[model samples]
Target: MQKISTCLWFENQAEEAAKFYVSVFGDSRILDVSRFGEGGPGQAGQVITVEFEIEGRKFMALNGGAPANFTEAVSFVVDCSDQAEVDRYWSALTDGGAESMCGWLKDRYGVSWQIVPSVLGSLIGGPDPEGAQRAMQAMLGMQKLDIAALQTAYDG
Candidate 1:
């Protein structure tokens, strides 16, 4: 068990969100689910919390009433090895969500995610300052990151 895990507050879709997240990431699964009991705050049998794992990271989703809305201030970063991985995560996460600049997105449930290519760091922070700046410029214009484009910019 991890010492600390992320707990997402949801209005009433903790279980549904957990299931959706499990489907999106590889090596992910639902670990446990707690439901409301009789005389509880919510209706009996309704899900109260869901514990899930994504790529070995633990998370909990709670069906708290009037959940605090998620903002870009806090986002989960998904490091991608290549463009395909970035594309896949972008599609899955942005299905019903909004897109922001530079590989940032909000999932259908309003959770913020950063589906970034692993090379982004070296490209934008490489020894070649000019090349890195160019790569940064290219990245600024893109929504879902394109590894090829970033590489080209870095090479140029």
Candidate 2:
């Protein structure tokens, strides 16, 4: 078991969210699911918690009550190898969701995710700071990250 796993609070969509997430990331799978007990906070026999993993990172989704609060203060950053990977995640996560600027998206379950290219880190920390700045500026105008466009800006 992971010493510390990230827990996500959902409005009774823990199982659904876990299934959706596992479908998107090939290396992910649902480990276990715990249902609510009789007279528990949630409906009896309903999913209360789901343990899942994506790329070996453990996560727990809790089917808490109504969603009172969820903020962008915390987000999952997906390191994509290329534009195809980025697009795949962005499309899957943003389905029936809202798109935010600079590759940020709020999934249907109200979880914020950042689908960023792996090369983006190196570009931002590269020797050419000016180029990186331009790339960042270009990225700010995009909903889904475009690796080719970012690369163009970096090369310019």
Candidate 3:
């Protein structure tokens, strides 16, 4: 059991969200699921919480009541090794959600996710400030990050 875990509040789609997330990340799985009992906050037999993992990081999805206040203040950043990995997650996550610039997307549950390429971090953390600036500029205009394009900008 991890000492710290991220908990997500949902209207009633915790199980669905957990399955969706586990399907997206190859190195992830659904650990456990707890159902609401009689007289609980949620309907009996309904999923109350779902424990899942994405690339080894544990997270819990809570099927709480109607969302009163949930926003994109915090998000998960996925560092993909290639464009294929990015595309896989981007497509699955943005299917019933919205897409934002610079590899940002909101899942159906209103969770913001940054599907970044591993190389992007390298470019941004490069020794040459000019190269990093160019890469950053290129990233700013992109909705889905293209690893090749970022490399071109960084090498320019």
Question: Number of the top candidate by lDDT?
Answer: 1
TM-score of candidate 3 relative to the true fold: 0.90
Cα deviation at 127, candidate 3, in Å, is 1.8
Show pairs that collide, candidate 2.
none
Model 1, runs deviating above 4 Å: none
Which ten-residue region of model 2 has the weakest summed lDDT? 62-71
lDDT of 1 by residue, 100-125 (tens): 99999999999999999999999999
How many Å off is the CA of 41 in candidate 1? Answer: 1.7
Model 2 lDDT per residue over 1-156, tens place: 679889988877889989999998988999999997897876789998999999999999988888855679999999899988998999899998899998899988888999999998766666899988888888878889888888888888
Question: Backbone clashes in each candidate structure, one number apiece?
Answer: 0, 0, 0
The CA lDDT of each predicted structure is 0.94, 0.88, 0.89
TM-score of each: 0.97, 0.91, 0.90
Worst 10 residues of 1 by lDDT: 62-71
**Each prediction's RMSD to truth:** 0.8, 1.6, 1.6
**Residue range 1-156, candidate 3, lDDT tens digits:** 689989988888889989988988778999999997998876789998999998889999988878745566788898888999899989999999999999999988789999999888789778889999999999999999999999899999
Determine which window of 10 residues in candidate 3 has minimal summed lDDT.
64-73
